[model samples]
Target: MEKMTLSSKTREAQSPTEKWMRYLGFPGGILLFLLILFLPPGAGLSASAQSGAACFALALVWWVTEPFPTYVTSLVLMFLLLVTRTSNAKAIMDVLGMEVIWLNLLAFILSSMLVKTRLAKRMALWLVVRFGHKATWALLAFLVLQLVLAPLIPATAARCVMTLPLMIVVATIYGSTEATPNAFGKNLMLLNLACISVLSSITMTGSSANLIAVGLIQNMGGHRVYYMDWMRVGAPVAILTMVLMWILGQKLLFRMKPGEQVPQVEGGLDLVRRQYEAMGPLGFQEKKAIAIFGLVLFLWMTDIFHMRWFGVEISAPFAALLGAVIVLFPRWGILSWAEADIPWHLLIFSAGAYAGGLALDDTGAAEWGVRMLFGGMNLKGVPFGLTYTVVVSVMMYSHLLTTSKTVRTLIMIPIIISLAKALGWNPLSLALPAALCIDWVVGLPISGKPNVVLFSTNQFTVSDNFKYGMMTCTIGVLILVLSGATWFHWLGITPSFWAVAP
Candidate 1:
């Protein structure tokens, strides 16, 4: 058939390296599973625990390499876990019903309300019209846009898609195109790329991965992470990380030339203004969308105060459900079930990862692995500062290896919690700080969905992305380590300096 021929041509068009990596992914996963399954059961795990570890190792390999779609890989992992007797079918199914998964589902439905009503697009245009005259302010405008949209739109790719056309217009205004790229385009696209992910750390509802990390703390670490508790720690850290990234990125990483410092096209600003004017004024849909989302956000922000005022608390999922109900309520609602734009594949992917993570916890595999690994590292006498730094650094940089933030959280948080247990330290000390770093997936084009969406413009090279991302990540690590010592200690998240763990 013609479709088969087109598929063959597409495969032929790939680079040799891409072809090899893709072809090798399946065998690579199998090899890892077999290798780990047969590893000597030392003092760490029982036979079932070893099997659980093997399943996890295989999932990690396939997730990173992605032999199939990530969700399909997750499905395979779930079946393998049940087949290998690592977990039961009922428990695996139960993860899909968890509050975290419900939150993600409802978040996307609410996100669709914004997209359908064009509210997200409207906000982006207004900001650009207000502050997009100069190159410097234009970059900052998009950064601020990301911060505003992160909490509202749980999907980063959706946010990137909404703003991508705007990025192109701004890039063209500065005389850069796919054919004629310049530092201005580089800075504009890269800043949006980083901000879209980095700013997600600011709020607990910003990304599904943040919710996953928080859920793990309650389910695995046995402590609830209130929204404000997360906000108190993550807000300052994520904001500082974004501020430093913007400064260092514009000044040192991608310095603009004199000619490229200002808008090169005379009528480009008018074009953006006209685009905003084309929509005329805010319609009934936009206002209703705003009102519904406003209620959702107010409930989320006031969760800690809800018990005192209302006699009971509105959980994150229920608050989102309240808005979703309005968005889907017959003729009054904006979108129908088919138009909500929920990504069932991604939800399934999270469910699989969640199932795998909980399976490891239930079977004692995560603890056994952490003990065997950290016991050999001799972390007992090390200062808490050193351990915190190492854990945070590992979580921050681990995004470069794996493409999925959910995978990183599911695999790493449980291990970090177990490590905290083994080291006689508070789980939140290591887990919460590391969870804040989960959304900083800005290194490579493949690092995140948002990165891929922006990189499609071909405005910036991989090297440019690498340069800015590495610099920003380094700055981020230093900022976090500094926070761990001072701000975090003051907030009682991490212990004071000069204190060694027993």
Candidate 2:
């Protein structure tokens, strides 16, 4: 098998045509920006707003085409905003320290502790050993393991890396070698990737993209989505989707042989046991990391309780930071600064993106764009149920076009929020559901990091993934739409469709 780097797997091979497109992307973006900037001032947009609009156009082109690294584009965005006087240096710098950025940083630290202590691997092995006697049970074991680690790990790529080897071992145990694939191997890899993507949407800290969505919503003056709040709305959809995928895999996609129904592998359970035992006993450091993470989760979930009794409200970032501090405190700490796998590039990208968003909002560019795009649609008169359904569906299937979940969130959430304000509807009603769909990056091998990792296994082809992915993506969209009409209504996210005057 050929060994490819992570970057090589995630990035597609560029054709000569694509190379030309990349070359033209930057100049085209600048031209578009200049055109927008010099256009006649209509729709009540001021000169500064026009400049912001121009900056956004150029940023969008750079973001979508990758004339440079996305993080570089982000830095360029901040610089452009400053040069144009669309935003001041203090404002641009201030966005770098926003609560969202801190939450992401602390989450990275916590995740680093998990990776360093090897607790994540231990938990996965333990689960597979206990419940993986049957093919169906084995699949469910992986799904449940991912769900358990989603909040704690935060990074989808890291979790995928931790589980990929185990998945390969399981496939080999079932006699499904990459050279000779079978129903079980195909289903196992595809379903594992799908479940990881879906589970990421269930918690705010589940993925960086989720946090980006939440930050964008908060920037738009909507109510903050806390850990509990996201779980309340996203949990049902996530769980239902997982169950649906399991049914699809077992019944329709992968047909198990009669002998394969039971754990027929000569030493399937033994493999897991040996791996589990290799770690030896749980070390003191692992125990300390576990305790600190538990305390953080408790504080995050019970913020309201602490606020009422102690008159001190602890934000999610602060709680996470507190846990991270305890983990790095010299005497009791488990992780060292050198061991931290923090993606500094992502943080830099996020800072610039946040600054761009802030400039758009401040210069009224977001509002202007919203009016220009949706003002004539009379979307305000459409029933909330129908509108919500369409928006969620669009967001879910958008993965077919682009591979970057963070970029998708960056582009979609702000537009949805602006649309909500234009239509006189609660921004959360539209933005939350759309943001929740940010993690639905399962339609292609390039859709997300997990997909890339799983695809490299050679257990399945592109066609296999597309067939299963399209089916699952469609089902996921339907679940979100149905929930928006009923479940979300009960939670005060989706309004009564018929109650409003058309």
Candidate 3:
């Protein structure tokens, strides 16, 4: 559940957007599926491939619209896959056994260690006390908090749960509340939401979708993507994007008023200080959480050196399992099995999404779709730079339509990779960059779980979020596009934009 969505109530058919979606989502899914199902086969698309595409369309419609609970839609997807013979029951079952699912389970266990131990809260409060003196510094502290927590906790929701109260507390102290708010509160909440998403893009374990993308790249694209390989490219781009967002949000988007710039309530800073003091000295549990998480992170980061030093490789799932093992160990561990927060539904949902993706690949649906898409664009003589811009841009902005990162990865990555291969370009050059952009689900309050949780405080409006999201989205696209031609080209992740020809 790394990059686990935080808010379960985000799409609960209450809001105006979701209300319409509720009415239209199911019928829309069925119509799309029927239309695709009845399409006259041609252009190298097989019958099985056509069926797979239809199933994907239905599942995607439901996922985006939330006509059913996302998990319920996933269940229906699995059933449709089997009934339509898009993927066999055995292949669907094997989706549960993928390392991506295992990593997700273990990552949540690791996250529970941080949440239960209160280590994550302690770190967050300490940072704010150290940096929350001013509104600007306080916002930056939360930004740093998400960055620090992204790798350690693995689950984005868990990190949000840990820091959410702290965010509310700091926002309140700075004179922002649910009923009444200010620029400071708006910036704080929105900035934290954006950072949580973009920062997760840097590490493979930061979210399940990232891991799923890696698995797809390895299995379907035939190119292995290692943890460091993602971090090596993603860390620079994501971190820089977050910093820019931090600056642009406060300076350009949501400038603070003089009165709102400082703590509004009497002794506001003192309240934060008291909370930090209430944490008392670091206890045994906090130290152990730190130690356990430290060991896991070390393994995740130093993966390339493992084959040389240990004569064996510790994959991402195994590294997490090792840490989770220590966390659940009877004597050495801090939490009981009951204490670990594992959401089996979310896990199942992830499996179904991934299974649908693999079925598309197995049936050649993804390839056929990519070929049709590229054929219409007539990319025959297009330079890689221009084509690269279009590819990453679509992946970056696709969040507006598809709310689930898992669904986005399942739908987009295979097509992007297949498109790159069709053009004789390295798949990673297109696929990995597209994967990194998948986590920028910041445009709408309904875009992600954390956005919903933060929006509950009423600190930022839909318009406020939309404006900030567009700015960050545009910035992310520009950064990826520029980096593709320079930094990535220099690093050989993207060899040359000019090398690809038709």
Report the C-alpha displacement of residue 459, candidate 1, in angstroms: 14
For model 2, what is the alpha-carbon lDDT of residue 425? 81
What lDDT score goes with residue 307 in model 3? 100
lDDT of 3 by residue, 1-502 (tens): 0122233333345469778977898999999999999989877988888888888779877776767766687789899999988889999899889765676577668766876877765665566578867778878877887888787755555455446656765666677765566788889888888988888898987888999999999988899988898998899988998899888888998888877776665566686678769889989888998898888778776767899999998876788888988999999898899888676765667777767777777887765564455457755567888889888887887776545688778878888888888877888889999999878889976577566546545566556788899899999999999999998898888867766574
Better of 1 and 2 by lDDT: 1
Which one wins by TM-score: 2 or 3?
3
- Which ranges of candidate 3 are over 4 A from the true structure? 1-11, 133-139, 142-240, 247-269, 379-474, 479-502
Q: Count the backbone clashes (under 3 Å) in each candidate.
A: 0, 0, 3
Clashing pairs in 3: 1-104, 2-207, 3-207
Who is ahead in TM-score, 1 or 2? 1
Ranking by lDDT: 3, 1, 2
If the candidates were sorted by their TM-score against the true structure, best first, what order would they fall in? 3, 1, 2
- Candidate 3 global lDDT: 0.77
Q: For model 2, how does the per-residue alpha-carbon lDDT over 1-502 read when each residue is reduced to its tens digit?
A: 1111112122331468657657898899989989998899876788877787788678767665557765687789889888888998999999878765676567667766776776765765665577766778888888887888777656566566546656765665566655666788887898889888888888887777889888998889468888888988888888798889987887887787866655445565786678779889998877987798788877765665777877997767777788888888886688788766555665666677667766766776655554454445566677787777767876787665444577667767887788778777889998998888888888765466576557656576555677788888888888888888888889898888554423
lDDT of model 1, residue 14: 35
The ten-residue window of minimal lDDT in model 2 covers 1-10
**Model 2, stretches more than 4 Å misplaced?**
1-21, 127-273, 372-374, 378-502
lDDT of 1: 0.76
